[model samples]
Target: MNALQLSGLITAVATAGIVVIGLPLAWLLARRSFPGDVVFETLILLPLVLPPSVVGYYLLIALGDAGPLTSAGVHLLFTWQGAALASTVVGLPLMVKSAKAAIASVDPALENAARVCGSGEWEVFSRITLPLAQRGIAAGTVLGAARAFGEFGATLMVAGSIPGRTQTMPLAIYDAVQAGRYGDAHSLVLLTSVLAFFSLLAVARLEQAGATTPAHGAPAGGV
Candidate 1:
């Protein structure tokens, strides 16, 4: 695939992975308050507050060929998959936090109502709770995708900006700048900015729509 297409694929895969893992974790954190929950939340969010380079460095030590992961024959550094891994790690916190907020916004009464109606826990979550919070999850997915697309420092440290391979749009832009290819860098920056802006706008619109929609009685799945 071309550079742009490959980067798009990477972002999609990373976002999907983050959503799949982070959503359930977010639900657990949001719905089931427990001891050390705050600590666990903070740990999940560390990547957001920490420097990307620091996260990348740690990933490298864990996943690089010469690192401990090598003993298990798991190599991640300097590959496209490594870039996706870095993106997923950095994006996961955002996804989790957004998902948690979304879940929190869902009324407990709705869930209780479903439970009272003989809905199982899984049924209530899949049918009632998830639909109610779908907007938030959608917003989270968009935000996570945008973050992944723009990720640079960590991806660079672990994946090295190899054009048509490991180089994503952000990395490509940086490389263009470093090479004094101002026009190319400017084009890429503008393109990325536009895409990020539109994705955020779409999420905001979804959130608004969700807020405006009235809740109905439980369907087959409780939603």
Candidate 2:
């Protein structure tokens, strides 16, 4: 696949990973304060503060031939899947932070009311919490996707830049620059800029719409 196609694929995979893993974690952190919760959250947010190359180095070791995953017959080294994994790691913090804030903003009374109506945990989360917090979750997901799409350092370490193989848009741009393909580099830069602009614009719109929307009372007719 071309760089654009490869980036989309990687972003999709990474985003799915983020949503599946990050959202629940976010909810737990937002709602429950247990012992060692601070430490646990710090570990989760480590990648955000650490250098990308450092994160990449750790991933490379973990995914390399002698790594535990390889011992388990799961090979991710130098593959697009590896790239997606890197993206997921780096993007997770943003998703968790944004989603946690959004979920926390929701009134706990509404959720309590749902439970009072005999709603199960899943029902309360799905019918009440999720609807009210959808915009924030969406914004977080979009930001995570954008970060994944533009990933470079960690992706490069785990998934080498092989054109039409594992080369994502960022890697393609790097290759272009090193080869003195200025025109190609310029085009890729513009493409990235356009994508980033649109992603931020979408996030802003979602936030604005959420802010303008009126808060509702307890769900009618029971959950």
Candidate 2 residue lDDT tens string, 55-114: 999999999988999999999988899999999999999899989988898999999999
Model 2 residue runs over 4 Å out of place are 214-223
User: Once model 2 is optimally superposed onto the true structure by TM-score, how far is the C-alpha of residue 150 displaced, in angstroms?
Assistant: 0.7
Clashing pairs in 2: none
lDDT for each residue of candidate 1 in 121-223, tens digit (9 for 90 to 100)? 9999999889778888888888998898888899999999888889888888878889999999888888888898899899889877766665443345421
TM-score on alpha carbons, each prediction? 0.90, 0.95
Candidate 2, poorest ten consecutive residues by summed lDDT:
214-223
Number of clashes in every candidate structure?
1, 0
Error (Å) of candidate 2 at residue 208 is 1.4
